[model samples]
Target: FYSELLHIIGLVETKVGGKRLIERNSEGQRHSGTILEDTIIHLDSLDKISRLSKAFIYGETHEERLFNVALGLNITWINRILFLKLLEAQLITYHKGDKSYAFLNLNRIREYDDLNRLFFQVLAVKHEIRNDDVKKLFEKVPYLNSSLFEPTEIEHQTLFISNLKDEKTIPALSNTVLKDEQGKKRTGSLSTLAYLFEFLNAYDFSSEGSEAIQEENKTLINASVLGLIFEKINGYKDGSFFTPGMITMYMCRETLRKTVVQKFNDLKGWSCVEFDELYNKIEDKKEANEIVNSIKICDPAVGSGHFLVSALNELIAIKSDLKILQDKDGKLLKFYDVEVENDEMIVTDEEGHLFEYNPK
Candidate 1:
C-alpha cells in the first residue's frame, strides 16, 4: 500500500518537476517513457526493493536507529559533519557573498574537492537547505576527520577544482534523482528500485562460507536495530555478562598497575632456573614459550570471542605502552626478553634457536 503511494507520489512529483517517466530492461538497459517495460524480474520482487528504498528515502525511524547501533553512526550527524567540512572549504569565498555548499544536496557529490562550490550551491538552494543552519553546524566542530573521511586528492584543492569544472549541469536534476553516465537526468519508474532489489536479494540469504553466521544457532537479524536487540538477547550487549562494568574497570586498573609497577615484588630475590635451563629438559620451544610468557584465561560463556577480543586489545595496549617506554628510555624494558619485528615476536630458545610467534 505504502509502496503504491510512493509510486503515485513519485509520479506526481515528476509531473510537478516537468519530467516524463521511463522503462528499463535486463542486460542492464534503460529507456525513457510513461509505460514500464516488463523484463525477467517481476513486479513482486521489485516491490521488495521499493520497500527498502523507502527505508533510505523516507529515512525510516527503525532504519535510522539501526544505522546508529550497528554502524555507530547517525546519518544526520554524518551529513552535518560533511556539511561543516564543506563550509570550511567555502569560507574563503564567504566574504564575497559567493555561496556554494554541495553536501546539503542529499544527493551524491562526486567532486569532493569542490566542497566549497558544493556548499555555495547547496546554500543557494533555499528550499533544500538553509544557510543559517549550515553556519551553525560550521561553528561547532564536534568531531575530527577519521580514516573513513580523511581528505584525498579529489578532496583537496588542485584535483577538486579540476573535477568540479568537469561536472555537467542538467535540468530538473533535483526531482530527477537517477542519472546516466553522461549526466543525462533520468525520468521513469526509478531504476534504483530494481538495483536495490537485486542488492537486497543477494544479501538476504546466509552464506555457508560466512563463519560468523554458521557458528551462531539463531537466525540473523536483517536490520540493525533488530540485530542490536538480538545481540543483547544473545549475550553480546554491553559485554557485561562476561565482565561487568565495575569488574572490567577494576581489572583494567589492576592490569595497568601490574604493567607499571611489576607485581612480582615478593619474588625479587627468588630466581627460578632460567627459561633456557628449565626448557632444556623440555621437548620443544613452543612448549617452553607457552610456559614462560603466555597466560590463557577462558570466559565462562565464550560467545563470539568477546572476552578474548577485549583481552587481546588490553594485551596489545600494554605492549604498546611498554614499547613507548623503551623508546623513551633508550633501553629494553622488563617485557623485552622477546623482540617484536614486523609484528612477529621472536624469542631466543635454550639452544639459541629463534622461535617466532607470528599472530596472523
Candidate 2:
C-alpha cells in the first residue's frame, strides 16, 4: 500500500517533475469533458528544468535530487498521518467510541487545505492561543506538541501537501488495495487525497482491548507495524536492506538480556551470570526498579527504531520476570504476565486475557 502511495507522491510532488502542464481552453480554465487525444511529451526548452534545480535547498546538484527531497517529505507526512490515525482511534476508544476525535475521516478533511489547517493551526499551535475560528472548529482536538506537526525546513522553500491541486488525479496502481462496489480491486484514476484516506479506512485500526484473532476482524496494527511500514518505505527508493523482525527480535533478546544482567551485577556486588538470577536476589521492588531504570541502551543508526522498540519490549519483559515491573508508584503488577512476542509487548492477566488500559 505504501509503495503505491510513494509512486503517487512522486508523481504529484517534487519540483523536478510532476503534473507539470495541462491544456487550457479559451475560457482560461483547464480543458475538460473533451474527446481523448494522444498527448506527446515535450522539453523544447530547459528553462523550467533549470529553475527547478536552482531551488534545491540541499545543494546545487542534479535536478533528480528533488525526487529524494519529495520522498523524504512524503515519508515524514506518512508517519505523521499514521500516528494521528492511531491517536484518533485511541481517543475514540478511550471515550467509548466518540466520533468527535475522528479527524482522519473524509468529512473533516476533504482537501489538502483542511489537512494543512490541522497540521499547523490545530495541532502545532498551543490550545489557549489558537485562533478563534480554529478553536471553534477543532475544539475537541487537543494540541499535539510534536515537531512532526510543524512544517519542515524544505516546506518553507518548496511545495507541500497544501500546494497540491485538489482536482488533480493520479492513475491508480494496478495492484491497489482499494476495492470496487462489487468488492473487486479498483482501477483507473482517483484523487490522491481520497485514495490515501480510503486505503487507510479499508482496514480496521482497532485500539480496542481485544487482541484475539477474530476471522471477522481486519488486520491489527500497533506501533510495531508502523516501524515495519517505515522500514519497507525506506526500501522503496534505493532497495535499502530491511532488517527482518526475526533479526530484530533475536538481536534485542541476545543484547538486552545480557546488558540487564551486566548492569545489575555492576550496581550490586552479586556475581550473577544470568538476568533471571536477580529475581531471587531482588527484595525491594522500588530499589530493583531503580537499578533497572538506570540501565541505558542506544542504537546509533535507528532508522525506524525497530531495534529500539524490540529492546524496550525486552526490558519490560525482563523487568516483569524480575518482579521489578512497577507502576509510577512502584507497585508491582504481580498478577499480570508481561512478555514480548512477535516484537509486540503483550500483557495478560492470570486467566490469560489481554490486558486493557483504562486511563484513571
Best by lDDT: 2
Best by TM-score: 2
Question: In model 2, how large is the Cα lDDT of residue 94?
Answer: 70
Q: Write the per-residue lDDT of candidate 1 for residues 1-111, one digit (tens) a residue.
A: 112212311222122133322111222332221112121112222332233433353225643322222222112122333334334333422333223322222233333
TM-score of each: 0.21, 0.81
What's the residue-level lDDT of 128 in candidate 1? 32
lDDT of 2 by residue, 203-247 (tens): 656653454464545556666666767766654444444577678
